[model samples]
Structure formats: C-alpha cells, structure tokens
Target: MGKYAHLNILLAEDDSSIRSAIKAMLFDLGIHKITEAADGEGALQNLIRTPQGYDLIICDWNMPNKNGLELLKDAKMRAPSTPFLMITGRADEESVMKALKSGVSGYLRKPFRMNQLESKIKVIADSWSEMA
Candidate 1:
C-alpha cells in the first residue's frame, strides 16, 4: 500500500486547474480518498459535516467566502488533532507567521513539486505515528 493511502484529505482551492493538479499529485502518491471544495466555505462545511472528520486538510491561501487561514483556524477549533497543510503564493514573513499562529501543520508554496508534497505528507505521518 502507498504511504498515505489510509489518509482522508480535504482539498480547498478556488482555482480548478490547481486543484486538479494537486489531486493528480495526491493520486500519484497513492492517496485516492480526497474531498475537494472550490472555496474555503465549502471546505469548512465539509469538515463540519464529516462525522469522523478528515485525516488531513490541504487548502489554498486565497479563496472566495473564506480564506485558508480562516478555515484553518476554524477547523482547528472543530478538529484540533487533524493536520492542515496550507498552499500559498504569498511567502512573506508576515503571511508565514500568520499561518503558523493559526496552527498550520505545514505549507506548500505555489508551483510545488510532487516530492515536496510527499515530504510534507511524510512529516505529518511521522508526527502522527509519534503521537500514537
């Protein structure tokens, strides 16, 4: 089995093309159980509705209705243990600090490679194992 095949991931990104690309990458990593949302609000709704909740959340920084940071904060409130990966084009110190403060598990900068995504996921998985 793939390293992340057991994970249920929620993806929130306003850009369809980028979402598709990330989905493909996730599949390549052997993660098939992905729930996608075109905006942050929809993603948050999904999080609320999923009784078992997701294993991880991958979200874009900018979106209509709610941004990724807002979603991250809200999701943390709902499912504090679930890991969150924020994808952002903005790499400024302020933006990074804000996301960290909101409790983002990791980050993927715009135009990331599959290996980079895998590395981030591996880190999350390792952390979970440690906790277990």
Candidate 2:
C-alpha cells in the first residue's frame, strides 16, 4: 500500500503542531513506527540510547539546543552509515549543498505534503537497503 512498507523513523522537530501533523501523515501512509524528539539534543540522546532502533532519521534544521546540521554530524560520527535527512524551511542552495556534503541522506523544504515525505522516505529506504 505504501512505497515503504515498514520503518522506524526518528523525527526531531521543535514545533508541537508540526510534530503531530507529521506523525499523523506518516501514520496515514501506513508508517506507525516513529520516534519523536523535541530538539536535536533530545534526538541525539535518543539515538545514543537506541542506536539501531530506527531505519532513518528526519531532523529539523533549526531548533533550540543543537541544530540539525550539528545533529547530522554527530549521528554520522556515531553510526557512520545511518541515513539522516534534513527537513527544514531553509531552502537555500548553500544550505542544501552543505547538508549533502555533511552526509545528509536527503533534504526537503517546509510546507511539503505527505506525498513528498513518502517519496523521500522511499528513497532513503531503498538506498539504505541496497547499501546493506
């Protein structure tokens, strides 16, 4: 029914409304295995605690305590091959390129629909599986 059948997704978002919306959308797409963190700090803590619990991580670029880029760096350093995606309102070319070079699996701009989310998830899932 969905492009990605089953996956454990880590979502790091500071906004409560967006977090709820994202979870609802993902659930609607038949993805229920999700972990939420309010900020990058909490996201990192979660990752460190459960390193292999997730198949992918969707992180916000800007947050109160550690930002997404910082979190991405930390995650890659810790897990090395874990795919970390950056979903943010910042859509500038410089930021996007920086994220790619920093080992971000993918980047999506804000105000995106559930379809966009699904597509990115599928890409990450497919690539990760291939690599594995």
Candidate 3:
C-alpha cells in the first residue's frame, strides 16, 4: 500500500475470483485502498455511500443487475472528475464506442494481463496531470 498510496481504486466485478485477482494486483502495487462491489447496483450503492472515496473505478460490463455502463453513468453523475476503467469480455467496436461516448476513463479487453493493467494505469496517471 505504501508503494502506491496515492491511488484509491474500486473493483466493481461480480465474479469474486476476478475481483480478488484485481485486489491482489493492487496489493502487489502496494495499493491497499481499494473498494469492491459485487454488481452494478452494489457499485452505485458504494458510490453514494462513500462519495469521493474512490479515485478510480474498474467495472465489468455484464452482471446480474445494472451492468457496468449503467454504473458508469451513475458514477459520472456523482463524480464527473473521477476516473473510470471499464473491463468487458465482449470486444466489439460498438460496445467500445458506446463506452467511450459515455465517458469511460479507460477500457481494457477481458483476458488482460497484469502488465496491461499497469500500462493503462500509467497512461491514466500521466494524463491526469494534464487535466484541470
């Protein structure tokens, strides 16, 4: 956590396994300030309940309820400046464009490696400096 104390990432994945893996990555990066939600509805609840608690949110597209895109809209309403990273198993251009138009901070295809995660984080961190 000390290694990346500056980041507060949220893992909004329904699968406990994937969520755990993401959390583990954060732990490896020394980022212990991560929050988790089981579904889009749960993620919304977390956003409302813990406003400003998350600097970044990584969400899965498909879920039992609410879905990641819906959560993205809600999160944007709550924190327009907050960064959102969407993860989708469906790798179609339509879905990608829709998410981009909806204001995702980043998008990563499923079956992504930890290196991909790290690289995306670096890009986001670098871009954040230019944001007012």
For this target, which candidate reaches the highest TM-score against the unseen true structure? 1
Model 2: per-residue Cα lDDT over 1-132, one tens digit each: 665547888899999999999999888888888899999999999998994667889999999899999999989888888888799999889999999999999999998999898888889888999998
- Candidate 3, overall lDDT? 0.86
| Model 3 per-residue lDDT tens digits across residues 70-94 | 9999988889888889998988999
Candidates arranged by lDDT, highest first: 1, 2, 3
Query: How many pairs of residues collide in model 2?
Result: 0
Q: Count the backbone clashes (under 3 Å) in each candidate.
A: 0, 0, 1
lDDT (CA) per prediction: 0.94, 0.89, 0.86
Q: Candidate 1: where is the Cα deviation over 4 Å?
A: none
Query: RMSD to the native, candidate 2?
Result: 1.3
Candidates 1 and 3: which is better by lDDT? 1
Instruction: TM-score each candidate.
Output: 0.97, 0.94, 0.93
lDDT tens digits by residue: candidate 1, 4-42: 899999999999999999999999999999999999999
Where does model 3 exceed 4 Å of error?
1-3
